[model samples]
Target: MKEIRFENVCKSYGKTEVVKNLNLTIKEGERLILLGPSGCGKSTTLRMIAGLEDITSGSLYMGDKRVNELPSGKRNVGMVFQNYALYPHMNVIQNITYGLKVQKFPKDEINLRTDAALGMLQLKGYENRLPKDLSGGQRQRVALARAVVKQSDYFLLDEPLSNLDAQLRVSARKELVKIHELYKQTFVYVTHDQVEAMTVGDRIALMYQGHLQMVDTPENVYNRPANIFTAKFIGSPPMNVIDMAFDNSNDSAYLAGQEIPLQEEWRNYIRQTGVKELAFGIRPEHITLSKTQLKNGLKGFVKYVENHGSSYGVYIDLEGNEIIAMSESNKWPPKEAIYVEPRLDKMHVFDKQTTNSIGYPTSIR
Candidate 1:
């Protein structure tokens, strides 16, 4: 299987640019998810690889050869589109065998590959049903079968599970992974849904506003975000950010004019950096709420509570800033006074001016 590389790739239509200076490499035999919100240029990037979109500048490589002008049919890539893209008029077996037949494969060879794909995608008994007659999940499987029969070097899926219901999506994701293990093809998956990105990808390539933001394993992207946008985008409740000021004389940080109890190491790092204005971030799960005022705690009032099945999200108002803390249950009513405490090790600090992470300031003693 071949890997795909993008070197300073940019895509534009007339004057409006979509993908800007993208530099990323999808490693061989690994699943890489192109993840971001709508209009982030994720689908455009995928299309570029599929040769469906032109790269206005820079180079795209498949393995060692530049494939910037390769035709879609000659790229040795099997793609599943967001709509499943199955032929409405063709039955399951016909759709799966069409490509092989078009390529002039032997009749026996076509039947063998088509039958294998049908069994693999659990469409054994539905071979005679047309795409219009199949349900969303079944049509999706037919699309998968079509791609699978090709057995190309690169397998690309653009939000293939987006149209399925929740339960079907879960099973489809598993099937995709299983298929990857069997084929060992380089997989490029595109999705705006973070859950699919987290669960399916070997590494996630996050994009924003046509720029590639960060690329890393799902765990690093969640816990060690590169910037404010990444930190805020990965979580369900998101990370809470508060503007803070540092007092040089006292070697302390203040939030809403209340002195924060900064640990000695953090204070040392802060002093070393000399960034007077900082943005402090803590995830909802790392914040604790106390009814009684604890020493060095930040005072706040309960603004609201939301139940997320397993836990309660307690939103608190600290002066004008609103933040959330996850609790096992919702005991505090709205307007109740509360104190918020954050785990020091789990805290995130960012440069206020650039909105980039300072990287959990710490060093060997």
Candidate 2:
């Protein structure tokens, strides 16, 4: 069952729309990541689900019940804020049980839930420590425990690991998945971090400029992006998008005035689309930098190279456009003339006017 759903839901602050007409669904026990850059309304969308933000128009349903007018307390969702939202004066034990105390849950039940949460989150011996005294990871655990104690069917977290250092964030992510496994809930995580979204989310709902860009699994979001925004957003160096035009023949396309051959399936697809002006996209890792010209290679000069520790990024100047190609070795120096050949099967062609990818080869269907 779809545990949460939005139908044309929109939220605006007076004249400015914060969330545009949104149509999305969160499944019963799936972890859905609401991913986008800051001010893209991912947090606002999460707030709307928790009933903290009012839906200016349309319907929001939680398990067949319209929750547009529901109060925050009545919605019964457990949320962890970006700041962790732990009470400064309260100790870990008190902070985790405070919600249940307010709700008047029986003393014995509250103790049982608190014990379970504390043990699961590994805070058994540190219950006496106040939020101010705990480490960042410990504090985050306390905040998570507070939510876990509620045992709500819906779990929400907004940039929960953004405050931690790189290594701590990695460990926290694992804990979150572990928590979800112990008690399966409809998890909605909001983050600007693509790494977090790709790692923890069962599916990612990518948004941009208050619009739902695409909703797909991490693999599809990375490999088969719906539009230019998603193609550029999900990757580290991002996809290399170069201006291309269909040549007189369907078997080839022109990139930087060089005719590059297309695979038979891509040729057929582009020919079927009949769009002359095109934006060709390929991931950096899919591109190979060669010292000598190869078949279907575009000639370019090496602008510079960047060491990524594990891999090297070779920036090549294709006419006036700069494209990055990932290499295992950095043999080419500055100003070296080289060729870049994109994997034919990995190429993505988008309609220049609409900025939408022409669907993959029919064989991919």
Candidate 3:
């Protein structure tokens, strides 16, 4: 395995820059994911690392060696694409050993490596089966097996599970994790699925509009997002960001007509930054519903409810704004009137103008 580094890397098509100046480092044997929506330049970044695209500026490194000029075949990287990309007439064994055959390895060595890959991927008895004969999940395993048999220093996976059904994707995720654990190789995966990035990656790089937003573990990104774009993009159903104005006329700040007690450090930060407008944010799971209003909260009407089998989502209208909360209990509040109090410690505060988190300091857990 090798450490991968990108220093101020960029890509452009004619005059429009697809990937802006980006810098990142992926540790050896680490599982890193690039996550964002379409046109966010994630795939372009992956292609650059795989030597399939030219870097418009900056440098790329594998460990200490600068590889910005290396060709794809000479980079010693294995890539698995969204489509299987298998030869139509080739069977599993042929597909797995094709690289070795082209390299002119001994026939016995080819058999040995192919057999090991087949066994590792749980394709032990399907060597002769053609690609058309295999299921989607099985074909995916074959793709992985081929990458494994190549003995590459790094693995690049670009939406490898997007072609599979939901159930198969779930199962395949576990399998991919196991394969990473067994092989102990540096893996860089790209996908738009936040769930996949959260569950699969050791560290995630969140991007938007060709810019790198933040890079951290799943828990850190979810609990203490660096900016508003991350908090709005990383979670399902998203975080509730209520518009609020900080009243600086008094000695302390007030949010929604309620006094906000700032931590000693945060008070200093606000004073230094000269922040005036703030947004109060919280996740759905951190809210509790009641029939009466609390001293520091709001009373709202339940607009609708969604039953997701494991839990219920109660959407409420607070004043004129909408907020959604997740409930563990099957019993729900009345649809007409209800109150919600967000757990104070679980709340987030962001600059209303810049949209960057400013409430609490966090460390990776």
Candidate 4:
């Protein structure tokens, strides 16, 4: 296992910069995930670490050695691409042992490594099967087996489960976690799927338009977001952000002309920042919905309802803005207005101008 570090890294295409002044350290034997939408420079960042792309400016270190000028073959990194880049003519054993053979490893050592990979990946019975004859999940396993046999210091996977079906992807993800547990190698995975990132990564690095938004554990990124973009991007239905007006004179806050409960910490934050307007955010799961009005609640009409097998997603219209809430009970009165209230302790306050979250209360944090 090895630790990877990027110091003041920058990547550009002529005058167009795709990665800007990145500085991060991936700890030894850590599973770090790079997550973001397409064209967000995640794949580019991975390639740079693999020595496939040269850094425009800055230094990259693998453990104690500086590898900015090292060739990919000398970097001791194993890569698995999204398309399972397997040779169609080569069977499972041939594909897995090809790299060792090219490096001229001994016959006994090659056999030992191949056997271990096949048994660990659960591809023991399909050793002679060609890529065309195997299932999508099976092919993915072959790809992983190939990378495992190399026994490199670092393992890089770029959207390795994008091609599998939903059910198959779950199994594949579990297998991946198991493989990592057994090998304990440094892992760096890239994907745009939030579910995969939350489940597999020890720490998540969220990127947007060549900038690093936040790097932390999944729970912190979800509950206490650093900015408005992180709050909106990490959740499934996303956090509902409502524009609100703050009255600094009396230490009160209102949303759409309705007064909402304000905690002491929140009032202090508003007074300290001296901002008259801010964005109020709360996750759908954190909001409670009821047919009757509740204390410190906003009234709204039920606009639509979506049944999601386990829970019902209720969309309510408050004046002109829309708010979503989740409910375990699916039964609802037709065309009836419902009242929704956000948990005061779970609310998020953000600066209107910068779209960055203001500090939360100590109890909430």
lDDT, each prediction: 0.91, 0.92, 0.84, 0.90
Give the per-residue lDDT digits (tens) of candidate 4, residues 3-78: 9998999999999999988988999998999999998889999999899999999999999998999999999998
Candidate 2's residue-wise lDDT over 82-191, tens digit each? 99989999999999999999999999999999998888888989989999999998999999999999999899999999999999999899999999998899999999
Give the per-residue lDDT of model 1 (tens digit) for 1-365. 39999999999999999999999999999999999999999999999999999899999999999999899899999999999888888998889888888889899888888888888899999989998899999999999999998999999999999999999999999999999999999999999999999999999999999999899999999999888999998989999988988887888788877888888888888888877669988899998779998776899999999999999999999999999999998798999999988887788888989888876554521
On TM-score, the candidate that comes out on top is: 2
What candidate 2 gets wrong by more than 4 Å, as runs, is 248-251
lDDT of 3: 0.84
Model 4 lDDT-worst window of ten: 330-339
Error of 4 at 3 (Å): 1.2
Provide the global lDDT of candidate 1 against the true structure.
0.91
- In candidate 2, the residue pairs with backbone N, CA or C atoms under 3 Å apart (3 or more residues apart, or in different chains) clash, namely none
- lDDT of prediction 2: 0.92
**Candidate 2's TM-score:** 0.98
* Model 3 C-alpha lDDT per residue in residues 74-97, reported as the tens digit of each score: 888888988979887999889888
Q: Which stretches of candidate 3 lie over 4 Å from their true place?
A: 251-272, 329-335, 359-365
What is the lDDT for 359 in model 2?
A: 83
The per-candidate count of clashes, in order, stands at 0, 0, 0, 0
